[model samples]
Target: LCLALQDRLEKVEKEVQSLKGENLALKLVLEEKKTFASVVKDGEVEVDSWKVVAASATKCTLKRHSAVDLNNRFSTLSDEIRDCGQTRVMSTVIKTVLLLAPAYVYLYINAVYSLKSSHLHYREPLTDLVSQMQETSTAVQNSTNGGHPSTSVYRALEIDHTKASHSLWSEDAQCSKFLVNFGKNIEGTLLLSFPRSGNTWTRYLLEGATGIFTSSVFNDPSLTKAGFLGEVSSLSHNNTIVTKYHFLQKNHHATDPCILLIRNPIRAIASLWAFKIVTSWDVKHVAVIDNSRYNTSEFRNFYQNMLNRWMDVIRNALENSRLRLLPMYYEQLREDPIKEVRRMLNFLRLKPNEERLVCVARHITGKMKGGQKKFNPYTKNEMNQAQEAVKIVNNLLVKRGLPPLPDYSKYEN
Candidate 1:
């Protein structure tokens, strides 16, 4: 009994020592937390104090104090703060760009629009000034010719056929008083002819009589300089009265009215050859056919091919087209200017004053008249070929109830 009592006293003393050590640690923890005079129990210590837990069935552990790990927590918190700051900066940059982008685009477009408007505003007055200058020059020139006040004055007076007798006979047609069909709501007439068939000379007469410009698919600088202003105009026929077209297949006016101007194939071929020789075959040159090249194998071959082409064009026009055709013979036009001009005007639905008709008669023989060949340029065999082509083409014309071509004796002896 005494030994058991002594053992109990030693155990009580060890527990008292443990309790005293824990009490010191509790005071230290309270001091760190800045707590004054904090009460500690026998078994419990202050917050985050290093201590051991009592366990009977499992292992007990001594845990580290919360305050002791302050350095590690501070390092982790600094990294999180840096990441959050970077994220906020990036978000601000993206939002600023998105908000400003549309404003920048709008400013750029507005600047361009303002510049274009300013340019057009400045350009309009300069155009008007140029046009006024041209009109004034034309008026001054008309005053010098035949005591006419102005071109417009004479034209307006001539349009009123009742007062045309009182109107001054002004030769302004030679000065290319013809107007282009720009913005005019009129369909065009196709003036179809083969090469070297007096197409240019006919155009000069036509424009003089009608006071309207003619156009061509070809941009002939020669004709343009000769006052055919619509030479380089649009091929759509929206800007010209009559368009000269050589190829029948290339005719855009399939259903439109056509004026088929026929000339002797032999004369046309001979004239074309002379033209090629004089102008070096450049279509842009205006050349009168003189006795330049003749009676060669080259001429013979060219005649054969061109004669076939001439026959083919005539055949195609008569066979394929259902449009109203006003066939004009080149020979008949050369014979009488007044009669042919009146007939042509009737066909084209135009009424010209007698004063303009007199002016057209005065300017009948244009500057482009080819030099007359006194003798037949073709050889015996070539003449036969040309005669055969003419016979065939004339028969085709007569069968279609069209006028037969006049005698082709201009090129013949």
Candidate 2:
């Protein structure tokens, strides 16, 4: 009897110790919840602590409901226990077990309450966190798109992070099903510029210097046998394929090195306008400003919009280390075409042969021989508007350590 009594005492002592620990934890949680509830009522929430406060309030609300249900369940269970007269059949040891068991019961009830409260507490925050992630994903897509969602804009939509990137990578649209697919390869050199910035001329010069023909980055069937490519497939040295793109696009191969040809917006505006006369290439994904859209004859505002968009492209390009930038000005091309072509050849890692130099000379002569460019068409007021636009772009580029494109209004072509 003494041994049994002693065992009961030990069990009682252990329960007492456990109950105090559980009691303290519950007190702390409840206090935190109460504090949160008061803060919420006051209508001022610290941004960092807002989530915690919200969670605590939810937990407290859940705890209250759980406690009420638990109280009713215990009352019913106690009545049933007394009516069955089960307590009378117990031996002294069993009775002792029953006497010491309320602490365990209390612990069990508190655990269930805590678990329910905790579940309610975490749910809202988890939902908010997911909402925030979705918002960030959307922001990423829009920001990457320079301006509007189009083929020319380099878009990184939410779908890109999930499944679309995989689809783009695995399936090379350039290949016919009859021809074996050569898989996605992001290797090539990109000759990129704003439209009418001597991009085609540069491409021709680069071709002579490297003995490589250029392809359009876009998959126009008119440009190539393979229509609408995300990137040129092969990266082999034997391949003499350099690609040209009018604008920086979202799917453009970031892995390729680029030569950015910046022209004087004043002159480039005229050059772009004249391109209607010279070429008939079906370019895609580029924003073409219609001459009629300019509300004023000066077109300063019109050129300003293009300049702003171009700067955004340059800023995004600066962020990407993989897209190496080799900037050349159109004015520099006029200063010395041979030197510029040789410098570009160096960038492409190709040596110019006698035949190549001869070809380039012929190419430049042929361009010079072409019909007179829409020359001296703009009034002095129009020229001044262009110069003002150049100053805005120039000041911004100079600070960034990028070369400023010279205003060619004062100089003869």
Worst 10 residues of 1 by lDDT: 24-33
lDDT of 2 by residue, 1-413 (tens): 23533453345444534643652222223334345334332223344454354344323212222333433433443333223321231132122222322322223223323332323332233223222222322222321111223122111211112211111112423211111112222246666777667765665465444434455645445333322222342334213335666666554557677667777665566555544433445432123444454445445455556656555555445445543566778778756676677556545544334334433453453221112243444557766765666676667556555566665755565
TM-score for each of the candidates: 0.54, 0.42
lDDT of 1 by residue, 181-240 (tens): 232444577788888787877777776677656789887877666567767765474545
Report, for every candidate in turn, its global Cα lDDT versus the true structure.
0.53, 0.44
Whose TM-score is greatest here?
1
Q: Estimate the Cα RMSD of every predicted model relative to the unseen true structure.
A: 41.7, 27.4
Which residues of candidate 2, in runs, are more than 4 Å off?
1-187, 219-240, 249-255, 276-304, 313-315, 366-385, 407-410
Model 2: ten consecutive residues of lowest lDDT: 159-168
Please list all clashing residue pairs in model 2, or write none if there are none. Answer: 153-250, 154-249, 154-250, 155-250, 219-228
Model 2 TM: 0.42
